[model samples]
Target chain A: EPEVTQTPSHQVTQMGQEVILRCVPISNHLYFYWYRQILGQKVEFLVSFYNNEISEKSEIFDDQFSVERPDGSNFTLKIRSTKLEDSAMYFCNSASDGETQYFGPGTRLLVL
Target chain B: SQQGEEDPQALSIQEGENATMNCSYKTSINNLQWYRQNSGRGLVHLILIRSNEREKHSGRLRVTLDTSKKSSSLLITASRAADTASYFCATDLRRGGADGLTFGKGTHLIIQP
Candidate 1:
């Protein structure tokens, strides 16, 4: 089965540095989403994208966070300035019907 | 109470035994989804039960949704050692699939061989 794919499986960056995480969602899916999971914590939604624009976002998706579909295949999440609290496993997901979503392997972001 | 709160944070069962997990949500939901995550890995979609549906099955997995009581259950029957993983129940309000999912803390299952 086709699945979502993400790049830079592991990343270590200094605090205050900018970082961009990339994802390639399933070809035919209409909705894409970003979610993060802190160590030993629940998965938290960051943002959802559709029709080349953001459809919904959470409080965690603040000024420092932004998501874009730069092209037909790539969906990117950029953090203007990394914070220690931003360290987590960021997962990209896509769904064709909006109810069942497939997830990527995730990018582990570590800021120190 | 938080949305999509699961009970029995941890469970240990022997191989070939049945494992069941329960989740409760605070608000109205259009659908409920279950996901399994191995340690430090991504989520694996297990099953989805719509608000109007009472039960759904896939392979050995069984899910039941009760909108009136605002609860759901995931039962993995005749499980194996590979079934050890953290299982989470998420509530989706739909909003045309625009809204984000509210996930529970998850139940950690251990299937001993």
Candidate 2:
């Protein structure tokens, strides 16, 4: 199993500001995913990446959100403008077969 | 949108007891998977049971899927203090070609040793 590591483990930003969260230590994963869990809420899927492009995204992934696998290995999720509601645990996961996803420790984002 | 709802938002049991968590979904799914998450940590995949298949087991974890009822259950035998965490049931909906999973509000399990 590949070890997934997320940078900055914790992020705090002002509302309406822009923030970029990253997932690294990526090896040979073909499928990458982003999910968020608001406090006391369910883990909701934000987007999925395959073949270097976004294969799918949820409604929560609006215009303000974007995902990129820049530099071929570092996958990132960028929020153009953050809101208080965006405060949550952001998880970055990768899978080899796209079936069983291995998750990162998670980055807890707090927007004031 | 299709979603999974876990029953008994939280559970507590003895270390040697069997722990069970049930989940109900709203739509058709190709498979159901169980995941465990320690407090403020990442999710670890436990097991997956396909729609056509009834039950699947991995280590001490057992998962059962009932397509007719759109429900699933996870059973852990001989639980331990290390087993305390949140268990979530996620569904791979057949309706979506995308591989994103629909996850339920997880059941927080606490094993008292």
Candidate 3:
């Protein structure tokens, strides 16, 4: 089965540095989402994207966060400045009609 | 902020036994989905029960939804050691907005050999 794929299975960056997490959702999927899970915490929604624009975002997705589908196949999340609290497992998901969401293996972000 | 909260934070069952986990939500939803996640991994979609549906079964897994009570249950019968993982229930609200799924803390299930 076709599945969502993410690059840099793990990322480590300085506290004030910028970092980009990339994902390639299923080719035919229209809705894309980003979620994060702090260690030992529930997964939290970050943002959703459709038509190359942000549909909705949570408080955690402040000015420091931005998502882009720079190409037909790549969905990237950029953090302008990383914070220690931002360290978590970031997951990328895609769904056709908001029914069943397929998730990627996730990228573990560690902000030092 | 309405999310599915699963009960019995953790469960330990013997192989070949049945394990049941319950989830409760606070809002009307279009569908309820169950997912499994291995430690440090991504979520794996297990099953989805729509609002209009009451029960569904796939393989040895069974799920029942009670819309009136705003609760759902997932049962895994004749489970194996591989079934050990964290199970989460996610709610997909009916609103047409950018409503992403809200997940609960999840239940850590461990199957003993």
Candidate 4:
């Protein structure tokens, strides 16, 4: 079965640095999303994208974060000026019909 | 919060036994989905039960949704050691279009051999 794929399984960056997490969602899926989980915490929604724009975002998705489908196949999350609290597992997901989203393995981000 | 909250934070069972996990949510949902995560790995979709549907089964996994009560249950029968993982219930709030899911804290299930 086709699955979502993410790059840089693990990322370590300085607190003030910028980082980008990349994902390639299932090719045919139209809706894409980004979620994060702090160690031992429940997964929290970050943002959702469709039709080349953001559909919705949570408070945690502040000015420091942005997402883009730079290309037809690549979906990316960029964080500017990372904070220590930003360390967590970031997951990318996609669904063809907006339900039953399939997730990628996730990128572990550590802001030092 | 619109998130689902699963009951019985943790469970331990012997191999070949059945394990059940329950989830409760505060708001009306369009669909409830069950997912599994092994430690640091990503989530694996297990099954989805729509509000209009009462129950669904896939392999050894069974899921039931009670829309009126705003609760759902996931049952794994004759489970193996491989079934040991954290199980989460996610609620889809949007009635028609796709939306991000609000995940539960999850139940840590350990199957001892």
- Sorted on TM-score, best first, the list reads 1, 4, 3, 2
lDDT of 4 at B89: 99
CAPRI class assigned to model 1: high
TM-score, second chain, candidate 4: 0.96
> What DockQ values do the models have?
0.83, 0.65, 0.72, 0.80
Off by over 4 Å in 2: B95-98
Report the C-alpha lDDT of model 4 over B20-101, residue by residue, as the tens digit.
Answer: 9999999988899999999999999999999999999999999999988899999999999999999999999986565689
Chain B TM-scores per candidate, in order, are: 0.97, 0.93, 0.95, 0.96
Model 4 residue A107 distance off true place after TM-score fit, in angstroms: 0.5
User: Could you give the CAPRI-style class of model 2?
Assistant: medium
Model 1 lDDT, full chain set: 0.94
In model 4, residue pairs whose N, Cα or C atoms come closer than 3 Å (at least 3 residues apart or on different chains), thus clashing, are none
lDDT of candidate 3 over B1-113, digit per residue (tens) = 24799988999999999999999999889999999999899999999999999999999999999999999999999999999999999998864455588999999999999
Query: What TM-score against the true chain A does chain A of each candidate get?
Result: 0.98, 0.96, 0.98, 0.99
Give the TM-score of chain B in candidate 1: 0.97
Q: What share of the true interface contacts does candidate 4 keep?
A: 0.69
